[model samples]
Target: MERLKKLMVGLILLCLFISCSQKNNKSDGKLKVVTTTTMLTDLVKTIGGDKVVVTGLMGEGIDPHLYRASAGDVDKLSKADVIIYGGLHLEGKMAEIFEKLPELGKQVLNVGESLDKSKIHFIQENTPDPHVWFNTDLWETEAKAVTKKLSEMDVKNSGYYNQNYEKYKKELERLGEYITNRIKEIPKNSRVLVTAHDAFGYYGEKFGLEVKAIQGVSTDSETGTKNILELANFIVQRNIKAIFVESSVPKKSIEALQEAVKSKGSEVKIGGELYSDSLGDKEHNTDTYIKMVKANTDVIVDALK
Candidate 1:
C-alpha cells in the first residue's frame, strides 16, 4: 500500500510539473503561496496581504502530525510559487512531499529550521519541539522570517510586506504583555498546565508553567495505561484544578486520565478545548493566529486561576 501511494504521488507530481510549466505567469499577478499548517497560513496571509495568494493545506481542528497530503493538496502545492511550512517534522506525514517539492524547483521555507537553535526546546537529542508558535517571542521571530520571505518573493511589494510586519509586531508585543499579566493571576503552585499532549512545552517554558501531558509531542504517539496512571498521580498530588483537551486530538485519553484521578479519590475538571494544532473557526473567535493564542491563554488562565 505504501508503494502504491508513492507511485500515485509520483504520477501526480509529473502531471502537475507539466501543467505548472505551461503557466508562465499568474493571470492575477500575485505570488501563489501554499502553506501546510494554519499557523503558517495565517503568517503568510498577514504578511503577504494583497501581494500574494495563499492556500493552506490544513484547516481548523486538523492535526498536522498525522496529516497526509492528499492528491489535491499536492496539486495545490506543485502550482505554488512559494511553499511555507512549520518544519522539524511537525507535518510528519507530508515531510516527504515537502522534500520533493524543492527538487521540482519550488521555493520552500521551513520556518522552524530558520529559527535560532539556542531558543529551541528538544524532547531529546535532535528532536526539537515543533510547537514553537505557542511561545509569543519565538512566534515573533517566525513572523519576521515570514515577512522576509514574502518580501523576497514579491520585491515590488516588499515595503508593503514590511509595513504589515511592523504593525503586526506591535500587536505581538501587546500580546506578550497580555500573556504575562494573565499568567500572573494564577498562583505559582497552580500554574501547572496539564493537557492531552505535550504540545504546550513552548508555552510553559515561556510563561513559567509546568506543562505535563498524557502523550508525547506528536498526537500519533501512543497513550499507554502506565502513562495515564502516572499522570493521574501527578495531578492528584499537585491538586491540579483542570486538564485541557486539544481540538485536534481526541478527548478520550484525557477523559481516561480524569477517571484515573477519580479512582485515586481526587477530582479534576475538563478546563476547555485548546487550539493546539489548529486554530478555531470564526464562530469561536479564534480564526486568526493572534486570536487563537489569546483564546488559548484565556482558557488556561481561567482554569488554573
Candidate 2:
C-alpha cells in the first residue's frame, strides 16, 4: 500500500507540473471545475452556470464504483481550480486520487459529504450507499453544497451561483414529489424494486418501496450465487412482474436473474433501463439529472402499474 501511495503521489505531482502551465488559459476566464459523476457534473454546471467551466470525469454509462482516474483525468484535475466529486465510495476506485488532489493546493469538494451524515444509509459498517442523488431531497442538499463551493471558488459570481442553486433546488424538491406520486401509481403491494446492484436503498426508503439488488452497494463488489438464488426466489414469490437494469452496469446479471425466474416457472420482465450510477447520453431524454429521474420514474410507473 505504501508503494502504491508513492506511485500515485508521483503520478499526481507529474500531472500537476504539466497542468500548471495551462492554468492561465481558461475557456472564457471561468473557474475550471472537474467533477466525478455525470450527475455531479450536471449539478455543478447548473449551479455554476456561465461563470464556471466544468469537465466531468465519468461520462454516460460510466461506472463510478469501478472508475479509475486515467492519465488524462489526472491532467484535467491538475488544471482545475476546483475539484468536486460524489462521495461515500461512489468513486471508490478513485479515492486515492481525490485524496491526493487537495495536497496540490486545489480546492476539492466531496459534494455528498455536506449532508447530515445520519441520513446516509450504510450497506455495511463503513460502506455507505453512494447513490444519494437518487433521493431528490438529498440531491437538493448537495446542490446547495455545490453552490457554496462555487461561491467560494469564484466569489465574484457568488450571487449568480446562489440564484441558480435556489432555482435548481426547487426543481429537485418538485422532482421528489413527482417520484412519490409516480411510485404511488404502483399498487402498494407491488412497490418493490430489484436492480443490478444495491444502489437504490435510499430511493426505496424515501419512496416507500422495498428494494432488492443482486450485488451490494458498490458495483466493485461481485454478485454472489446465494444472492442470485435468494433474489430469484424473491421475484418468484412476490409475483414481481419487472426488474431493472442499470445504465452503468452490464445487463447480464439482471438477465441471469431473469433466466433464474424462468427456471422456476415464472417470467420477470426487464421493464426498461434505469440510470443508476450515471446519466444517459446527450440525445436521450435522460441526458440531464432531472430528466434522468423523470425517465426512471416513467419507466417504473409504466411497467409496474
Candidate 3:
C-alpha cells in the first residue's frame, strides 16, 4: 500500500511536470544544476564547464540505492535551474522527487533515458539494470547525452561542450581498450566477479566475466541465508580464489560468504574493495569515473591472477 501510494504520487507529479502551468521564465545568469550521483555531477561539471554550477547529492562511499533526500536536499532541488540523475531507479527512493521537479519548471533529465531501450541489459524480466556506467562504451553514450543537453541549455557554449565531449570520447575509447587488454591477462575460467551485490552485471556482460552477488540488482533486495550458503558452495566448488566487497555495500555480506567457505574446510580471500555504487575517496586514484573503472579492473585482475 505504501509502495502504491508512492507510485500514485509519482504519477501525479509526472503529470504536473509535463503540463504544469508554472515554469522558469528565463536563464537567470548561470544555470544551477543538481545531480543525484558523483558520476553525473562530474560529467556535467566536465561538459557544462563554466556555463553551470553543479551540486551532487551522493558522494564517495555513499550508496545511492540506500540514499534518501533530506529536507536540505529538497530545498536544493527546489532551487535548481536544471536537475539531472542516473535514472532507471538508480535513485530508487527519490522517484517522487524527480516526478515533481518537472512540474515545477525545472529541466530534469535522466542520463539513462537517452539509451535505446532494447540495447540495455534486463536482469529480471523487464527490469533494466541501471549501472550502465560500468561499461565505458555505454558510459560514453551517457556522456554524449550530457553534451547534447548542455548544448541545448547553454547555446553560447555548445562548441565548448562538443570539444570536451570529443576529448572525453577519445579518452573513454582508450579506457575501454585498457580494460580489454588488461582483462586478457587473466585466464578465461578465472574471469568470475563475485561481489556483495549484483551491480557488475553490465561490466561482466561487456568485459567478459561471470558475475555473482548475494544481493539482487538493488542493495535493498533481501538476501537469505540459503543464498549465501549456496554462493559459498559455488565459490568452493569452482575454486574461485577470491570474492570482493563493495565500497558502498556492507562488508558483512561478503565476510559471511568467506566464513561459509571456511566451514567447508576451504579458504577464500576477500579480493579487494570494488567501487559498485560509489567512487573512491579523493586521495585515491578512483576519484573520477574513468579512474574508478581502472582501479576496479586492476584489483580484479590482480586478485584473479
Top candidate when judged by lDDT against the true structure:
1
Tell me the spans in candidate 3 whose CA falls farther than 4 Å from its real position: 1-28
TM-score of 2: 0.95
lDDT of 2 by residue, 1-305 (tens): 97985787677766776676564566578899999999998998899888888899989999888887788887788778888988888888678767776666768999878989999998679988888888888888999888988888788889999999988978888889999999999999899899999988888888988999999888888888788889999999999989999989999999999999999999999999999999997688788999998998899888888
How accurate locally is residue 109 in candidate 2, as Cα lDDT from 0 to 100?
97
Residue 302 CA displacement from its true place in model 2, Å: 1.0
lDDT order, best first, reads 1, 2, 3
Question: Worst lDDT window (10 residues) for model 2?
Answer: 18-27
Question: Which sequence of candidate numbers ranks them by TM-score, best first?
Answer: 1, 2, 3
- Cα deviation of 61, candidate 2, in Å: 0.7
lDDT for position 125 in model 3: 82
| TM of each candidate vs. truth | 0.96, 0.95, 0.91
Residue 167's lDDT in candidate 2: 89
As for TM-score, the candidate ahead, 1 or 3, is 1
lDDT of each: 0.90, 0.87, 0.85
Tens digits of lDDT, candidate 1, 181-240: 999999999999999999999999888999999999999899999999999999999999
Backbone clashes in model 3, listed as residue pairs: 17-102, 17-103
